[model samples]
Target chain A: MGLPKKGPTLLKKKKMEDDEEEIADLSPEVSDSEPESEPELESESELEDEDLKLAEPSKNAIYNTDGIIDKLGDISFPDNVGWIHRLSVDIDQEQEVDVNDDLARELAFYNQALEGTRKAFEKLQAMGLPFLRPSDYYAEMVKTDSHMEKVKGRLLAEKRRIEEAEERKKTREAKKLAKEVQAQKAKERAKQKKEGIESVKKWRKQRQQSGFAKDDDGGKEMDFSFEDGKAFERSGKKRPGVMPGDRSGGKMRQGGGKGKSQKKREFRNSKFGFGGRKGLKKQSTAEATNDFRDFKKGNVSGNKKRKR
Target chain B: MGKKRKHSETVASAPAKKDAPERPQRTILGWKDKNNTNNNEAQVTESTVGFKNKEKDNKVESKESKGATLNELVELKSCSSCLFFECRKQKDLYLWMAKCPNGPSVKFLVNAVHTMEELKLTGNHLQGSRPILTFSSNFDKNAHWKLLKEMITQIFGVPKEHRKSKPYHDHVFVFSIVDDHIWFRNYQISVPHNESIKIARGGLENSTLIEVGPRFCLNPIKIFGGSFGGPTLYENPFYISPNQIRAIEKKKKAGKYAKKVKAKTRRKVHELSNPLEPDEFADMWKE
Candidate 1:
């Protein structure tokens, strides 16, 4: 009856042991310095302080001991612990203003909130009232479209222009290169001629031997010098070919018998027998000179008679 | 549930789009021949923007003069068809095309010939026909613009010795990129030379020359570098071919059918409610 219950006491001891481990884990300095005893000849009682300063093994041994030493370890938070450890649970607060207190004002908080809310709602309504009409939208779209087209057109024009410029530069560079090549060739030719080298001579001879100078009909020989390429030359004059009257000189069928003059000749021959051309021009001075003319007249009359 | 919600949203959006008017599109524009040779001779501002505005104003006035009808004689207005310079595609996505009004088309023989190319390029051909130089953008780089200017100078720039009191003597070209398309314009520098007042380079003295060109624009789709006619390199999808122009014309014609649509006429009568009068009060006493 004089001592506490066994379970609660054991529980308190276990809790103390746990707390000891926890405290040691949290801060080893607190537990480790306890044993050092470097205080000013220590202020607290030596017995309790010595118990705290003991090493883990010694402390466990003391815990196993059955007496006042075992009871030396006290729990930090016991189940039946009183609030005596804390100074106070709550502050001594005083009311600053009464709940029923009222003050005279033009508008209350609720009324002011409602008025502000109504004003905001009215503003929103006013803002929302002016909606987009179909016509306005269409006009905007058209305007935007026109602007974009202008931009696109401008861009396209610019791109084309740039590309064209680059091409022109390339052509210019090519021309410069060609001029250099030509100048170098001329220089080399002049040097070889001075040295009496046969290469240029041989090349010229070879070109002559290819029947270029005398035979001007060879189309390839016209550009043999490559000198004309330096400047633009007008295309050769394209003279019109001889007319039909001029082509009648050839005796044999006039080059493809399907010509108009040939066709007329055949028609006259069929009508006036063998001397068709002579008969038309000579005007038939002697009317009955040939039996063919009479036969032709008879043939025409006979055919007409048969049809009638 | 998610699928159903998405399907419903799509359906709702489809109807809304159908109800809204369609956007305009861009189409081929006919090259307008400016005959205001006198006004073009007037001294223009040094800035390009001002020059362009002056040119546009002239075109607008010309359009207004021609498009006026009996009913529309009160005020001059620019029709949608006549406003060809404005971009239609960027805003409403409607494509319109006008056939080139010129009859004789100048066709270029696009063959690869080193000698011919050199002759055409190097030879200072002073023939009156305005030369058209087309190049593909696939090979275009930073040097392209400078090259174009050089070519224009080589082809059309008048010599310093030949400078007279004429309005225009030296012509140059400026090339720039707009979107993926390319545009080029020809401009001539004029020097007013008076015999009485002599200056450097003939009688050319205190006078400014305006830029003038019968502008021509063409879109190139491909480029070739071979000696006789080579192969193509990069191809972009932004090319709108001449065939597309024809197709657009056909579709526009089909869509522009004139139906004799009879609009419903309505007539409202006040038979449902009688009109009140002072005589009714007098009649009420008798009743």
Candidate 2:
């Protein structure tokens, strides 16, 4: 049982047989100046991941290249065998792939499969072999009909989820645009009212300069306070800090940030008043009960008390 | 979920093969697990058998990790090759691929197993079609890899004219080596074909593949010269057993309390050795 010493390993070691027996107590220090030594050194220095290889190939690890090649020769088919029998294709990997990156690794495998299939198909075509299954061909499939149905259901569910999300996004955008439009309309209304008030004032000044022409109603000028901005200003007495057209008045409807219909309903309710019991407010308070001035004044006369 | 019905149906289909032994009879063996409620082992074995079309099953229960007994079983069956799935502690799955009589077997730690029953892998193909074997270019870079590739081609590739095999090719198998682990993938090739005899002119170009999966990644641990035990051809230098990894993790978690206690004691000792100086400001504040 003699092994051939043909490679560069022969220059480094005296006998191949001795190298096999010297498997015990072997370390990285034993193998020096080989092509793989530098990389192994780096691995030794770095912290290894769970799946990553050791910093260096173990010194005792056997190569047995000759034995492997011999076995390969013994087991492999004769050269004369047709490609149809083996039905295998080897495709070149373009670059080194990072295993940790799942997408990239899967993509690399997919590319290899795709390329190999393409090549195999071309060869099959050249050989005039019927490789592709026809559309009508039906037989027992690897997966059951029920299993495929489940797969279809899952795919449809995912699509539905995405579509629902898109619909929500579209509605949100439309709502935002509608709000901007409403604000613009309100601003334009205010501007138009201001212009109308200015035009009336100018007309009155011109009439005064022309020497007032008396009308039948004692030459009185019509007051324009209501037409001016003064009429739109919020009254301080009724509800302090309330905007004129704000039906909620920034209090009752605190966080009901709803659409235009909500505001309309609120305004209608404020104008007509909400329908409920008004009897709770009729009861007198303790302060009213203890008031002596109103009691004495009320006792003086019924007409005077009613007037007060 | 019709799981029981599906199992019975698959079992009924198993005995459908009655063909001449033109191809090498590759046998699969596994230990029986009584507590396995999901019957995960049975499903995995059956699905693999179903995928390959006609694989003979010979259940052998052995605790030894060596392939010596497996080699004997292979020779007894007159099988040329074998795939022995050895499940340990009902957790780890170690796959052994061996040439029957003479030598060269590989031990792989199987991870990321997704069986065909999983609904995510949607594609389906003819049950008995011979898959086209495709290998990445790196398989030829080393001597051990080349040998493993030969074994895989023989074991996984259904014979040319086996009676159980379908007439047309409609699926492919991918054996790729990434990060020193061989990953296996199966895909169904779908082409838009209208004719019975011929594919449309650009059908090959238009054809797309859908994954018909039982995805697995195999990390090779050792290559033995004989079928199960012999002179070591190669050993993965970086390979660490899952048990060791688990033990390391447990130790790390277990050490946390001890570490906290040790730090407390050390702080106390330091405080005793060097007491804080009594400052004049203490008297001023007290007064």
Candidate 3:
């Protein structure tokens, strides 16, 4: 105080003190950094009790956690044999907590069913109903969406294949019905065609019988007749080219083509009673239909010949 | 016609069951063992032990399946005594009763038919002091603890509230094996204040434990090799009934009394013949 304190001002002295403090704080940070980096140099033998204790509260939970996390899942339950055994196995297997609630619930139900079934079987044994055995739950399970669904899937696939085959068979039956309908239609069409052809032959024969013999020759364009005398004899009859008696004999009255030796066609020899010339030429067993044309049909007022 | 057929079937089945054993041999039980405990040699054949040991080996050979695992069989075989065995097959409603030759006069009938709902197989947990069935190495190795408990509860169910009026009417049976004999005990698991244990309500240790027994001894009538039902291997002849024991005791008492009366009358006659002769020398009844 007698020397510097008396001469120096108070504010200047305070400033000088603050500068010294700042330098003191800054110098050690730089100097001690190297030693601090060598953390391994903190020898165990030299370790003090103060260093051992947790000195930093900020580092307690966030930076240096002592694993309070597992306690979050803690569920307190009585230590019974069943639960203890279950937990022991679970712990041994080290399974993670299941998030799928449905699976866990189903498994619980399965365990219960299994337990009850086993108990019932045991009871039956005790009751001396020894022949009885527990039914196979696994077999039943395979038919459902259980662990054995793979078997069910294969069985379903086989069932589907059988169903598809049955469907194909149904379609084939429908096709067969359609083919039968087509065959019936063809039979009706052939019958109609035969009736039309018969009418044309009858019209030609009528023209010859109605004293239009020369015109009949023009219609056929050929004369294979050998019995010129019979043709002249037929000239007086109302039906000139046909005789009443010959109608029942030959299916057709062979007015022309006499002695030409045309092969005889027997209608009875045909399988379907058709396909022979003799079949179409049968004399009217029952009269032809009312739609028959008159003998004068298509014979112009006076017969006119076709241009050569 | 159906009734007649059913009756005929029953009659047919009864004889079939009776004839089913390897041989017509009944089980015999004895309180005392005939074999010397320290024979320290090869086993004494069952015949020497007074068992109808015929076809034992043959029956063992005849069993189709290999039989239960040795561990499972051990517990069953070690049950040396059984008070009775009643069988009620699945088809039959009524049970067939076969009381053990040496069994308690009183018994609780164990009926089996129950529904899934009545079984209450779920939501059950170990509570209070449950009956513990202690079996020897036989049960230890082969025992599945959970399965065993479920089976026990089903076989020995606790009576309902109304039926609890009589204590002995229902019981939980604990089966244990000691020295190759199955020691069966019946206990009622209830609060200690309910009487029986006689612990004075005093000792803290004794009051908490709820076990009570070694009450009944069921000498093994027969030890079949299989669980549920199996082929009989041995038939012992020593099983004595309680009535027989009582009758034998009465006969011995009557014989002793008759002898005493005859001795008294003979002594009176002997005294007239030779008054100086000692009582030990008195044999006038012989004359």
Candidate 4:
């Protein structure tokens, strides 16, 4: 019955062997010499590098035409094609990857596609079907691939240039408009001066006709004895005429004869009452004249006598 | 230290202990008697019969002195009767509240009222009292004079022709209605050429002195005879008639009167006329 006092030790040995087998299956490649390096550790490090590469698609190999086609399918175009075209036009023509050639090909293809799409859209519209989705249209027109980066850069620069040119044009227009306004004002001032000179000449003529010397100082006193004698001869009484030291008329002419003329017109109109009604002007003028005569004679006795 | 602390405590409590009064007080007997007498007098004065009798007598005396019967007095209401009457009453006094169309609201105490002629006759009566018709508060004395002149023109219905007089001394006028008697006074405001009695005498002679007081108050039957205790109407002094304006313009033209020049240097001769354009003259006349 005691046939095997070794049964207990054998059982313990078998359990240990099973545990070794399970460990080998779980981590088969791990060697005792590198016990700290697990399979999970190796794969995790490899995944980190992959993640880094995936982070920036434009900077990595995935931004290429093949990568873009693999990720987003065909029809990936750059949105800045116009700028790309302009840059190509400026660059050396001998270059193999001529941006202008690419742009022309792209533009022709886009035009054709746009025409076909528009026709299809019209047909769909007639059938009452939704035609183009804005997102899809932009996706087709914009290239997200790294191969189209130069085209996008060119487009952005051209946009800025166009805006700057527009601003310069607006500035030039403003300056031109301001110059025109200044010239107009200068012309008006010259006209006003001419008118003033003409009025002064007419005033001088009038003064000369009234028996005053043309070259005499307007403010100077003149010897009226001679003129008084002639006036007295004409009508036993002193005649009313332009007197020396009278600068009011001259000032009016220099400033603007229009004011005086306007005043005279207003006075005449008021006297005759001709503005609205008929015959009123004549009647009023006559009455005013009579009243004026009476006032002169009355003043000689009324106010002057009292003062004496 | 213990002794000092004890002393401080005593000092703090001393006032309270000292406030105990010697005895309680009672009202004096004279006080009661004085109060009783005052009450009796008040009661006696409060009797309706006695009060009515005294009030009637006072009213009768006031009416006779004012030359107004009780019924006539009642009929002569306050300025509330006039369409232009705009005033407020405080207690027994009626203040002249000016609702000026061209000025800020002004409240003035009704100082006095004088007839136009009376104001012109009594020159010294308004000396102590500020001139009632003066616009000098808002404007200058010259402006006041112009306003007074306008008022006179409007009241007399006279044309602006008489404005040519250079020495317009007797132009300032005011009117007052006090009791039964209406007194006429004339005041002459003149800018003296020289401080001489002869000049003063001449100014007085040439000045207009109208006596408009006695004529109205003397005859009670007349509308203005009885004292009408209300606002007085004044003629606008600045108002000028068309004929007068025309006359002024004619004189201005014929005389060739130069405008008053504002120069530091004095001119040898002075022209006494206004020099305005024909149109300007017309404009002034039209106004």
Model 4 chain A worst lDDT run, 10 consecutive residues: A1-10
Residue A108 miss distance in model 4 (angstroms): 8.2
Flag regions of model 2 displaced more than 4 Å: A1-52, A204-308, B1-44, B64-68, B193-201, B285-287
Best by lDDT: 2
- TM-score, one value per model: 0.19, 0.72, 0.20, 0.16
Model 1 ranges with Cα > 4 A deviation = A1-308, B1-169, B179-182, B194-206, B234-236, B255-287
Candidate 2 collision pairs: none
Enumerate the chain B TM-scores of all models: 0.31, 0.82, 0.31, 0.18
Report the number of clashing residue pairs per model.
30, 0, 7, 33
User: Which candidate would rank higher by DockQ, 2 or 4?
Assistant: 2
Per-prediction TM-score, chain A only? Answer: 0.20, 0.55, 0.23, 0.27
Better of 1 and 4 by lDDT: 1
Give per-residue CA lDDT, model 3, range A3-85, as digits (tens).
00111111122333333333334344433453565454333112211001111111212211111111111111123323211
Q: How close to the true structure is residue B284 of candidate 2, measured as C-alpha lDDT?
A: 83
Model 2: number of clashes? 0
Task: Order the candidate numbers by lDDT, best to worst.
Answer: 2, 3, 1, 4
Please, what is the whole-model Cα lDDT of each candidate in the order they appear?
0.28, 0.67, 0.29, 0.27
A1-308, model 2: which lDDT tens digit per residue?
A: 01111112112123223333222113345435434647555534233223334446666766788888877887676666667777899988889777555567667777777777888888888887778677777888888898889988987887799999999999999999999999999898788678667767875895688566644446355556555466555545676655656788766545455668788987998987777766755678898778877555435466776777
Which is the leading candidate under TM-score? 2
What's the distance in Å from true for residue A284, model 2? 29
- Native-vs-model 4 lDDT? 0.27
Model 3's DockQ?
Answer: 0.01
Question: Weakest 10 consecutive residues, lDDT, candidate 3 chain B?
Answer: B1-10
